[model samples]
Target: MKSSAITCNNGSFFNVFDEGMSLVCDEDLQALAIAVIQTEMKAVAKLADRIDRQFVQACHLLLDCKGRVVVTGMGKSGHIAGKIAATLASTGTPAFFVHPGEASHGDLGMITRQDVVLALSNSGETEEILTILPIIKRLGVPLIAMTGNAESALAKLASVHIDVAVEQEACPLGLAPTSSTTAALVMGDALAVSLLQSKGFTRDDFALSHPGGSLGKRLLLQVSDIMHRDAEVPMVDDSVLVSKALLEMTGKKMGMTAVVDEGRRVMGIFTDGDLRRMLEKNLDVHATRVATVMTRPCTVIASDILAAEAMQIMEAKKINALLVVDENRHLLGALNMHDLLRAGIV
Candidate 1:
């Protein structure tokens, strides 16, 4: 009759009942964990077999829709329906979710003749959904239903039905929505991605939808947008003394400077790291030309390449800062890791 005692060890918490009856007793916990994972995995595996012509028809319907996709559900299905709508909207398909109960009130006005309806219900007999079924049909809107019960009223009435039946629930009592919900969510992702690819949705398109986030910066920011421009670009004639190059590097504070010929084309680069090696070889900074000590044929990026790509090249080449060059190798600007960090592309 005593309350369970909870304790933390090695970053995990465990519960102890009277007489050391552990809530997370190793054997029981392992069995429960494996059962949950296996149950959900099996549910997803079942979907593989269900992906026949119905799946293709559903995708085609969504792809060809001239207007937005309207999604609706009740309770737990409502939560999953919202996520599906969001995925579709963010991936080039316009979609929005409306609660079925609200639809009975006045939200039904949101649906237009050009819109498609998607409904979710595990039992496929949700009263709120069924109440509005006649109206949706009379309006001639194409209805797609995701449900476990093929015989349920909602499924039978839908233009296309997707089976999300799971053999069992991950919940020990078999009443909680565990495996069924996971299956529905996965199916939503499958539909969204397929539609995205069919429409040729590119990364740039996704970035436009998510312009306020870091992902947008990674996809939309080019080297030209963040690189040091005009006089801020570190450059020196190739014939300049290595000592003079060091002065330019220090003044610019980018730890490097581009070595350019008379035509202002990049010939090489000199960095603090190069200075260290030059000192080791007893090269006279005063007497040595920047060309003799510079790292020639250095890494360069086009001004138009994504800043994210520039970060990749810098990481791979084991260097910071790159000369921004034209297709013909004329120096346009310069960039370094700090620029990427500041631009939120790091």
Candidate 2:
């Protein structure tokens, strides 16, 4: 038993020493990683070379489509197809993913002649997908094929073929759909982005599609939609004592109040910031007038302005709240940065 233990220890020692002394240790693995990435990139780069009449025709068909872009695939291609559909849908191209299996079972009814079908298959032949090729052709809906095998049956049947062929798979066995799927995904992203640029998709347009997301809030939310309005606004006349304004401010819990004139136009703004400066000057809060300590030319914004733009202005001016005013400069509402934060517009 002792001899066996010594042999085992020697074996481990030799193994460690051999690995430490090896000059190419882990270098081959790094090279392989780089090679895989290069292969995927080269595949995508070939798209420019392949951009002939077929690509232009495909773009034209999609541009003229009045209905949704139906994207379908199988296995790993299906996952990529779903993402492509989502990207297209968000980028002005109305699209949805339909499982090829489900399409054969009656979901094909969701497709229309006005719509264009984007099919993904690395081999250009997925049995479930091919099974519906005839039906799609019969429906007279245009087929845009995204595949590696341009000579395959599906490609032959396609109205336009986009070759997303990769040199090889990243998998050592070259059996898993590694590089092929990556090529397909990159091609899909390229298509979506191209369509997006062609459509002149503005931020406002993107916001409309993403109303529940942060991007929508940034573009669609207006200051008037969130600010405290009318009776909810805390304000006082210049003649009012600082104590009176403080009471209004405290009651309203805005940490400040606007000082207005006889015309109901904002004359100045009083806030905790002003209070800090007042305390430093040893001024008596009760004896002071609202105008004495208020900040003049208080940053004001129109109610029609986007909340995100308002946030930018407030941040750039180093202020927290903005007095919302009308065209005639009458105080309409009040908004603090927190208001935007709560509304998810910040």
Candidate 3:
């Protein structure tokens, strides 16, 4: 039986039997993985240098576009284009992906003079994309081309060409689109974020586009939306007896009560913990005033703030509840950790 030598990172060799059997050590696999990552990193790093006048022009066209951005590509580039479109749309730009092949078959109508066309092709000469170039030109839409070949037909025809050329593919054989695709993806993110900043896009704007999950609940749900209102809020007069405040807390099941002054301004807070401390002191519940035993200057939140902010305050203070008040320190509502949990803000 004859065997061949396959060199590995440690200056050692592995056996490749004539029958096609091979043994790969773990060290060799790890080394190859690290090499791929390093190659892709270099590819992405080169894109920073390409962010010049051409990049600015592309951003301007996208920003000035009255209609949505139509991103088109073929094969693997198509997949990257789809993700780029999604990122743009979610970050404040109105954009969507249009398959080049589909565009040739009537989907080109999706692109108009008001829209901007962003095309991706590592080779700069994808046939499907080229097929629709004439129609896109006829529509008079601005064409932004991303390709590896600076002199390719697509680049020459583009209103602005972004050079995403990589020195080499990360694949050892240089047969795959690993490095090139990574560079293109990073460039897409750069464009999306640059436009995001230029347009003053905000977290509230992002929440509008994503309102179905926990993210939406965190950003869109306000303290006022979830807090218990006037009747449900556990509150008692500051001069009330500790026994009376305890009854309010028990009936409300909030484990706490707000002690308000005669004018309805929050004076203090009394919780189950306060009750336990009072018990240890042997204070007469019927004779002691709630103000004398309550926790003074308790944490309170405004009604208009996000519930997520209220959660942070509670977590940092190591408390389970918050009193919702207005600018005048008047009790408006109350909420506890359970409220946040139920609203999915926690």
TM-score of 2: 0.88
**Tens digits of per-residue lDDT for model 3, 92-124:** 999999999998888988787899999999999
Which candidate has the top score in TM-score? Answer: 3
**lDDT tens digits by residue: candidate 2, 224-288:** 78999878899999899888998999998888899999999999999999989998999999899
Stretches off by above 4 angstroms in model 3 are 1-20
Better model by lDDT: candidate 1 vs candidate 2: 1
Please provide, for model 1 over 1-346, each residue's C-alpha lDDT reduced to its tens digit, 9 standing for 90 to 100: 5756564554455677687574774556788899899989988998999887888899989998999999988998999999999999999999999999999999999999899999999999999999999999999999999999999998899999999998899998899899998999999999999999999999999999998768999999899899998899999999999999989998999999999999999999999999999999999999999899899889988999999999999999999999999988999999999999999987
Ranked by TM-score, the better of candidates 1 and 3 is 3
Per-model lDDT: 0.92, 0.88, 0.94
Determine which window of 10 residues in candidate 2 has minimal summed lDDT.
1-10
- How many backbone clashes can be found in candidate 3? 0
Question: How are the candidates ranked when ordered by lDDT, highest leading?
Answer: 3, 1, 2
